[model samples]
Structures are given as structure tokens and as C-alpha cells.
Target: MHERLSFFVKRDSALHHLNPLTKIVLALSIILVSIFSPWYWTSHGLLLVVIVPLVFIGKVANEYFTSALRLILPAAGFIFFMQAFFQPIGQTVIFNFWFLDITQESLLFAFRIATRITVMISAFTLFLLTTHPSELMSDLTRRGLPPQFAYVIISTLQILPQMQAKAQTIIAAQRSRGLDTESTFFKRIGSVVPLVSPLVFGSLVEVEERAIAIEARGFTSKKAKTSLYEISDRSSDKFIRWGLVILVIISIVLKLWLS
Candidate 1:
């Protein structure tokens, strides 16, 4: 499962036991507050004081931080640097890079955006790590989310690894035939046909078979479906969800007032 795109980890903690809907609400609320709140410190506070602490509270700190370092930090850093260098000219220049300048105002703006992104992705990362995809899908299905949507979501997550493996196989085969990734741009361009045709069409061809298989399982049946595993929700889950919802509403109100 480690090689799969789904990031769920097996953990025995209060967070892991929370109903999938509760966790989704929690993650969404944190993301909304960090992005839309009026206070300058709110995003940073949520990241440092809320999401980071929840990592340990959920007992998945190691996996969460691994995802942060491997995926979130690089993306946030790229956005930060791009904003810092390319933003409109301002008075106080802190650093210069040839034709580009980093000013205090742009630095502050970039930092704010980066912190918001960090909070948003971290919230999702924690939720994904603690909650299984099947549980999330099942709960959403129970809540009247379309069954097709659930199938698409779970299948999309699982398909990534298969696509990647197919790409690697194509690359290896091309390499054996003298295709070079490190070669000139034109050569790489030449290799793309060999590399991508099979990868793309291979996936496309399998879709029909997968659809047939799903239909065979009565995917579109009107009868009520049963879950193989039972998910439990408790009073605490309800309390946390309500509290988060109220907090999100307050944040939106504050943003409106400030504007």
C-alpha cells in the first residue's frame, strides 16, 4: 500500500477512529479558515499551533511530516520564490537576483500565501493519513453522494500507481532501444511518442474492461448496498464537527467585516 497513491496509514488513535465525514469537515474547515480569515497571523497559527500538533495527537507525525517534506514543502517553496521575485516592484529591496528584486512587501505577501498553502495541504495530508479511502467513500455514499463519484474517486487514487508502473516499463523498453532521457531536447521529444503512446492508450483501453467489471458487480443497481466494514460514529465526532463548522462560519464573518 506504501507504493499506492492513497496516503492512508493504519493507526490506533482518537483521530483515526473519527467518522470519515467528521474528518473531512475538520480538514475543510481548517483550509477555509487559513485561506479566508482576516487576521494576518491566522494561517501561521493554524499550521504551527493546530495542524502540527494534531500530527502528534493523531500519532501519525512521522508519516505526516514525511509527506510535508516530500511533497508540500517543495510546492509551497516554489510558489513563495516565484511570488517574491516576480511581484511588482516596491520600496525596500532585501535581495537582488540579476534583473529580479525581492522587496519587503512582496516577501510578506509571498510568506502569507505560502503559509496558507501549507495549512491547507497539511490539513488534507493529516486527514488522508488518518482516514482510509474506503471509509471516506462509504460515508459519503451513505450521505447521498453519488455512487459513481465514489467509484471515480477511489479508482482514480488506485490508478496512479498503475499508470506510473506502466510509464516506467515503457521508459525501460525505450532505454533498451537506445532512447535517451538525458539526450538533447529533440531526442527526448522523439522518445515521447514511443513512451507516451503505449502509456496513454494502454490506460484508455483498460477503462472499458474496468467499466464492464463494475457493471457486472451491479454497480448501478437500485438496491441498497452493504459495506464490508462497518464505520462507527460517536457523540464526540458530532461535537467536533459542529465546533469546526461554527469556527469556520465565524472566520467567514470576520473576513466579511474586515473587508
Candidate 2:
């Protein structure tokens, strides 16, 4: 599972060389545009055109699509069912079944919501695949974030692999003890409860141990903290950062004028 998370494109592309802060800002801007724009075709078309090129730039377009489908399809299904049956919109009803009505507006609304979520997820996936977690944390620290915050972010990334290994070990151990996770739906879920308890408990203990270790190492001292990696603001990164800002302004103006 962690291997899937490591589904990144390793390349010496311009997107890879960009500072994480630039990517984060640009991704967030795209997300904002998708969310705040009117749930209509014009707004979504703009986002689609803008983000499609990022796939080529990041060189993880295939993985990005897979990741988006893994998350977005199920979410879209839920939205479709809910909006179609429960919150039907529009003056004209297309279908009526018992107490539920499906309207054209509801369908369009669901599609809009699903597309918006897909775009946002794709943006984040591109960011994750293109930017290293360590570099992102370092960028955050350099941008006036607390050192402890950066440490937490970096630790989370490091812990994910450990957690995956521990989970697999726990599952195998439980299976040896006759707890079958491949059993019926409820039974499988029930098996997971016991299998996961030890992992969660172990993580809690590990966190405490890490906290103590940090304290022992004087991590909370008043002295400035030094990082192994330093974040430098390159000219190209600055140019892209400013360019994204301009694009965001243009997007907002277009939205206001068109809407």
C-alpha cells in the first residue's frame, strides 16, 4: 500500500525542480477556483484546460488518473445517488420512482460536484508525485512555519511506511491465530478490529517514546533548529510563484465577469 503511495515519477523536469511552495500555492489556487466558481460548465471548463497540462509537466499523469479514479469514482457514485434520489433539483422532473424524483438540474449538479472533486484530487496527486515530502516540509519551515510543525509533517510521511509494514505483520499474525480477514463482510471487519488494535496501541507507545527521545535531545530548546535540507528560493521558482498569482487573479476576474 505504501508502494502505491510511492507511485511517483522520478525525473529531472522543470516541475520537479520547482520549489514545493510554488506547487502548493498553484495547486491551492486551482482548488479554490474549482470550489468557488459557479457550478456550471464554463467554470469547470477553465479548470479542466488549466490542469490538463500539469499532467505532462509532472510526468505522473498515469498515476494521477489512477489515484483520482480510486478516490473520485466512489465519491461520485455517492453524490449521484444522493442528488438524484434525495435532493432532486430543477422545475422539470425527468423520473419519478416512489418518493424520489430525478431532475436534469440534479444530474448536472452531481456531475459538477464530482468533476470539482476530481480536479482537486488530481491537483493534490500531481503535487505529491512531483514534490518530495522532505522538500515540502523544509519549504514550510523556511516560510515561517514552526519547526515542530515541519517535524510533524515529515514524521507523518516517514511513519506511513512503518505503519504499512506493521499492519501487514499484524494481519499475518492474526491469520495464523485463525482470525480470517477474508471471511464474510462483517466477520472481516470484526477481524480487523483486533488486528488493528495492537498496531494502534504500538503507535501510541512509539509516539510517546519519540517524544521522550526528542526531549532528551533538547529538541525544544530555545536555540534555532537546523535542518539537514535547506530551502532556497530560486529565480525560476519566484517567477512561477508570481505567475500563479497572476493566473489566479485572472481566473477570479473571469469568474466574476462571466458569472
- TM-scores of all candidate predictions against the true structure: 0.91, 0.82
Candidate with top TM-score is 1
The lDDT, on a scale of 0 to 1, for candidate 2 is 0.77
Tens digits of per-residue lDDT, candidate 1, 197-244, equal 999999999989998998999998988888887789899889999999
- Say which candidate scores most in lDDT: 1
> Which ranges in model 1 have alpha carbons more than 4 Å from their true place?
1-3, 96-99, 175-182
CA lDDT for candidate 1: 0.90
> Residue 71 lDDT in model 1?
94
lDDT of 2 by residue, 19-137 (tens): 88988998887887777665477436745687777777767777777776787677767876786677756868888999888888877877777677777777777888888877787
